[model samples]
Target: MDATPPGWPEAVRPPGAPDWERTAVAWLFDLVPPDYRAHEVLRRYPVLLARFARDHVAAGLEAARSGWRTVRVELADHLPADAMAAAMTAYEREGARLAAAARGVAVVSAALRGERWVPRL
Candidate 1:
Protein backbone atom coordinates (compact mmCIF):
# COMPACT_ATOMS: atom_id res chain seq x y z
CA MET A 1 0.00 0.00 0.00
CA ASP A 2 1.08 3.53 -0.71
CA ALA A 3 1.82 5.08 2.66
CA THR A 4 0.71 8.47 1.43
CA PRO A 5 -1.68 10.12 3.86
CA PRO A 6 -4.86 12.03 3.02
CA GLY A 7 -4.74 15.06 0.72
CA TRP A 8 -1.38 13.92 -0.60
CA PRO A 9 -2.33 14.36 -4.24
CA GLU A 10 -3.12 18.02 -3.81
CA ALA A 11 -0.33 18.77 -1.37
CA VAL A 12 2.60 17.07 -3.12
CA ARG A 13 2.79 19.52 -5.96
CA PRO A 14 4.41 22.80 -5.14
CA PRO A 15 2.32 25.91 -5.89
CA GLY A 16 3.66 26.33 -9.42
CA ALA A 17 4.63 22.70 -9.68
CA PRO A 18 8.26 21.66 -9.39
CA ASP A 19 10.60 24.44 -10.37
CA TRP A 20 14.08 23.64 -11.68
CA GLU A 21 15.83 24.19 -8.34
CA ARG A 22 13.32 22.22 -6.29
CA THR A 23 13.31 19.57 -8.93
CA ALA A 24 17.06 19.38 -8.61
CA VAL A 25 16.93 19.03 -4.84
CA ALA A 26 14.33 16.33 -5.19
CA TRP A 27 16.53 14.49 -7.62
CA LEU A 28 19.56 14.72 -5.38
CA PHE A 29 17.63 13.40 -2.41
CA ASP A 30 16.56 10.39 -4.46
CA LEU A 31 20.14 9.25 -4.98
CA VAL A 32 20.79 9.53 -1.25
CA PRO A 33 20.62 6.26 0.70
CA PRO A 34 17.45 5.48 2.62
CA ASP A 35 19.45 5.07 5.85
CA TYR A 36 20.99 8.50 5.30
CA ARG A 37 17.59 10.04 4.79
CA ALA A 38 16.26 8.47 7.96
CA HIS A 39 19.33 9.56 9.86
CA GLU A 40 18.97 13.15 8.68
CA VAL A 41 15.29 13.25 9.54
CA LEU A 42 15.90 11.78 12.96
CA ARG A 43 18.70 14.22 13.59
CA ARG A 44 16.46 17.14 12.86
CA TYR A 45 13.41 15.79 14.64
CA PRO A 46 9.96 15.74 13.02
CA VAL A 47 9.06 19.03 14.66
CA LEU A 48 11.81 20.78 12.76
CA LEU A 49 10.40 19.53 9.50
CA ALA A 50 6.99 21.01 10.27
CA ARG A 51 8.54 24.27 11.35
CA PHE A 52 10.60 24.45 8.19
CA ALA A 53 7.52 23.86 6.06
CA ARG A 54 5.56 26.55 7.85
CA ASP A 55 8.42 29.00 7.62
CA HIS A 56 8.95 28.19 3.97
CA VAL A 57 5.30 28.78 3.11
CA ALA A 58 5.15 31.91 5.21
CA ALA A 59 8.31 33.19 3.59
CA GLY A 60 6.83 32.65 0.17
CA LEU A 61 3.73 34.59 1.16
CA GLU A 62 5.79 37.36 2.67
CA ALA A 63 7.83 37.58 -0.47
CA ALA A 64 4.66 37.95 -2.50
CA ARG A 65 3.55 40.62 -0.12
CA SER A 66 6.75 42.60 -0.77
CA GLY A 67 6.88 41.85 -4.50
CA TRP A 68 9.93 39.65 -3.97
CA ARG A 69 10.52 35.93 -3.55
CA THR A 70 12.88 36.15 -0.62
CA VAL A 71 12.20 34.14 2.54
CA ARG A 72 12.75 35.32 6.12
CA VAL A 73 13.30 33.29 9.24
CA GLU A 74 10.85 33.21 12.13
CA LEU A 75 10.58 31.49 15.50
CA ALA A 76 10.54 27.71 14.96
CA ASP A 77 8.80 24.71 16.53
CA HIS A 78 6.40 26.71 18.61
CA LEU A 79 3.23 25.43 16.97
CA PRO A 80 0.70 23.32 18.91
CA ALA A 81 1.22 19.53 19.06
CA ASP A 82 -1.78 18.27 17.07
CA ALA A 83 -1.28 20.74 14.26
CA MET A 84 2.47 20.25 14.31
CA ALA A 85 2.20 16.46 14.11
CA ALA A 86 -0.20 16.67 11.21
CA ALA A 87 1.96 19.19 9.42
CA MET A 88 5.13 17.22 10.08
CA THR A 89 3.66 14.01 8.73
CA ALA A 90 2.29 15.79 5.70
CA TYR A 91 5.63 17.49 5.10
CA GLU A 92 7.54 14.21 5.45
CA ARG A 93 5.25 12.41 3.05
CA GLU A 94 5.32 15.27 0.60
CA GLY A 95 9.09 15.47 0.81
CA ALA A 96 9.44 11.84 -0.16
CA ARG A 97 6.96 12.18 -3.00
CA LEU A 98 8.61 15.34 -4.23
CA ALA A 99 12.00 13.65 -4.23
CA ALA A 100 10.71 10.88 -6.45
CA ALA A 101 8.79 13.31 -8.62
CA ALA A 102 11.86 15.46 -8.95
CA ARG A 103 13.81 12.57 -10.43
CA GLY A 104 11.10 12.18 -13.06
CA VAL A 105 10.88 15.90 -13.62
CA ALA A 106 14.66 16.18 -13.79
CA VAL A 107 14.74 13.68 -16.60
CA VAL A 108 12.12 15.64 -18.49
CA SER A 109 13.70 18.96 -17.72
CA ALA A 110 17.11 17.64 -18.72
CA ALA A 111 15.79 16.40 -22.05
CA LEU A 112 14.15 19.74 -22.64
CA ARG A 113 17.33 21.58 -21.70
CA GLY A 114 19.48 19.19 -23.75
CA GLU A 115 21.30 17.89 -20.66
CA ARG A 116 21.38 14.74 -18.56
CA TRP A 117 20.79 14.15 -14.89
CA VAL A 118 24.18 14.13 -13.17
CA PRO A 119 24.39 12.86 -9.61
CA ARG A 120 26.59 15.01 -7.43
CA LEU A 121 29.75 13.51 -5.91
Candidate 2:
Protein backbone atom coordinates (compact mmCIF):
# COMPACT_ATOMS: atom_id res chain seq x y z
CA MET A 1 0.00 0.00 0.00
CA ASP A 2 1.55 3.24 -1.11
CA ALA A 3 0.89 6.25 1.08
CA THR A 4 2.00 8.92 -1.36
CA PRO A 5 -0.73 11.15 -2.71
CA PRO A 6 -1.63 11.34 -6.36
CA GLY A 7 0.80 13.53 -8.34
CA TRP A 8 3.57 12.79 -5.85
CA PRO A 9 6.83 12.46 -7.74
CA GLU A 10 8.29 8.98 -8.05
CA ALA A 11 11.73 10.32 -7.20
CA VAL A 12 10.56 11.29 -3.73
CA ARG A 13 9.64 8.67 -1.16
CA PRO A 14 6.57 9.02 0.97
CA PRO A 15 6.74 11.48 3.87
CA GLY A 16 8.03 9.93 7.12
CA ALA A 17 9.64 7.13 5.18
CA PRO A 18 13.40 6.63 5.53
CA ASP A 19 15.51 9.19 3.67
CA TRP A 20 12.41 10.78 2.18
CA GLU A 21 13.61 14.31 2.81
CA ARG A 22 16.89 13.65 1.10
CA THR A 23 15.10 12.19 -1.90
CA ALA A 24 12.68 15.13 -1.90
CA VAL A 25 15.55 17.59 -1.91
CA ALA A 26 17.20 15.82 -4.81
CA TRP A 27 13.95 15.68 -6.73
CA LEU A 28 13.25 19.37 -6.08
CA PHE A 29 16.72 20.31 -7.26
CA ASP A 30 16.07 18.50 -10.53
CA LEU A 31 13.09 20.82 -11.16
CA VAL A 32 15.09 24.04 -10.82
CA PRO A 33 17.68 25.51 -13.15
CA PRO A 34 21.12 23.93 -13.11
CA ASP A 35 22.55 27.17 -11.71
CA TYR A 36 20.46 26.72 -8.58
CA ARG A 37 22.72 23.83 -7.65
CA ALA A 38 25.54 26.31 -7.01
CA HIS A 39 23.62 28.03 -4.22
CA GLU A 40 24.98 26.87 -0.87
CA VAL A 41 22.08 28.35 1.04
CA LEU A 42 19.57 26.35 -0.98
CA ARG A 43 21.53 23.15 -0.48
CA ARG A 44 21.90 23.72 3.25
CA TYR A 45 18.20 24.50 3.72
CA PRO A 46 15.88 21.96 2.13
CA VAL A 47 12.78 23.97 2.99
CA LEU A 48 14.19 27.02 1.23
CA LEU A 49 15.09 24.80 -1.71
CA ALA A 50 11.53 23.55 -1.79
CA ARG A 51 10.25 27.12 -1.85
CA PHE A 52 12.52 27.97 -4.73
CA ALA A 53 11.47 24.86 -6.60
CA ARG A 54 7.80 25.69 -6.06
CA ASP A 55 8.25 29.22 -7.44
CA HIS A 56 10.31 27.98 -10.36
CA VAL A 57 7.75 25.38 -11.33
CA ALA A 58 4.95 27.93 -11.02
CA ALA A 59 6.82 30.31 -13.30
CA GLY A 60 7.35 27.57 -15.89
CA LEU A 61 3.66 26.67 -15.82
CA GLU A 62 2.71 30.32 -16.25
CA ALA A 63 5.11 30.77 -19.13
CA ALA A 64 3.72 27.72 -20.91
CA ARG A 65 0.15 28.93 -20.45
CA SER A 66 1.02 32.44 -21.60
CA GLY A 67 2.80 31.14 -24.68
CA TRP A 68 -0.16 28.94 -25.53
CA ARG A 69 -2.51 31.87 -25.19
CA THR A 70 -0.52 34.12 -27.56
CA VAL A 71 1.38 31.85 -29.98
CA ARG A 72 -1.39 31.82 -32.58
CA VAL A 73 -1.56 35.59 -32.69
CA GLU A 74 2.19 36.00 -32.54
CA LEU A 75 3.14 33.46 -35.18
CA ALA A 76 0.15 32.92 -37.43
CA ASP A 77 1.35 35.35 -40.07
CA HIS A 78 4.96 34.29 -39.87
CA LEU A 79 4.43 30.52 -40.00
CA PRO A 80 2.70 28.29 -42.52
CA ALA A 81 -0.71 26.96 -41.47
CA ASP A 82 0.66 23.49 -40.66
CA ALA A 83 3.59 25.00 -38.77
CA MET A 84 1.25 27.25 -36.80
CA ALA A 85 -0.89 24.27 -35.91
CA ALA A 86 2.19 22.32 -34.80
CA ALA A 87 3.31 25.25 -32.64
CA MET A 88 -0.07 25.33 -30.95
CA THR A 89 0.13 21.58 -30.35
CA ALA A 90 3.61 21.97 -28.93
CA TYR A 91 2.44 24.67 -26.55
CA GLU A 92 -0.46 22.56 -25.39
CA ARG A 93 1.80 19.59 -24.66
CA GLU A 94 4.35 21.71 -22.85
CA GLY A 95 1.64 23.46 -20.87
CA ALA A 96 0.25 20.13 -19.71
CA ARG A 97 3.69 18.91 -18.70
CA LEU A 98 4.40 22.05 -16.74
CA ALA A 99 1.04 21.88 -15.02
CA ALA A 100 1.85 18.34 -13.87
CA ALA A 101 5.25 19.50 -12.69
CA ALA A 102 3.53 22.30 -10.75
CA ARG A 103 1.36 19.76 -8.97
CA GLY A 104 4.34 17.57 -8.13
CA VAL A 105 6.23 20.59 -6.80
CA ALA A 106 3.26 21.60 -4.62
CA VAL A 107 3.08 18.12 -3.14
CA VAL A 108 6.81 17.99 -2.45
CA SER A 109 6.77 21.49 -0.95
CA ALA A 110 3.97 20.51 1.41
CA ALA A 111 5.88 17.43 2.51
CA LEU A 112 8.99 19.49 3.08
CA ARG A 113 6.87 21.79 5.24
CA GLY A 114 5.95 18.80 7.49
CA GLU A 115 2.56 18.19 5.95
CA ARG A 116 1.60 14.53 5.72
CA TRP A 117 -0.94 12.86 3.55
CA VAL A 118 -3.72 10.90 5.24
CA PRO A 119 -5.72 8.71 2.99
CA ARG A 120 -9.49 9.12 3.17
CA LEU A 121 -12.12 6.62 2.16
What is candidate 1's lDDT per residue for 1-121, written digit by digit as tens?
A: 2232222322233223445334434433343444545557723443333333334444443434443211122213565667655655655565555444434433433333434334355
Off by over 4 Å in 2: none
RMSD values for the candidates in order, in angstroms, are 17.4, 1.4
The alpha-carbon lDDT assigned to residue 24 of candidate 2 equals 89
Q: Give the TM-score of candidate 2.
A: 0.91
lDDT of 2 by residue, 22-111 (tens): 998899899899999999999998999988988898888888889889988888889999998888898899888878878888888887
Q: How accurate is candidate 1 locally (lDDT)?
A: 0.40
Residue 64 displacement (Å), model 2:
0.9
TM-score of each: 0.29, 0.91
lDDT of each: 0.40, 0.87
- Candidate 1: TM-score? 0.29
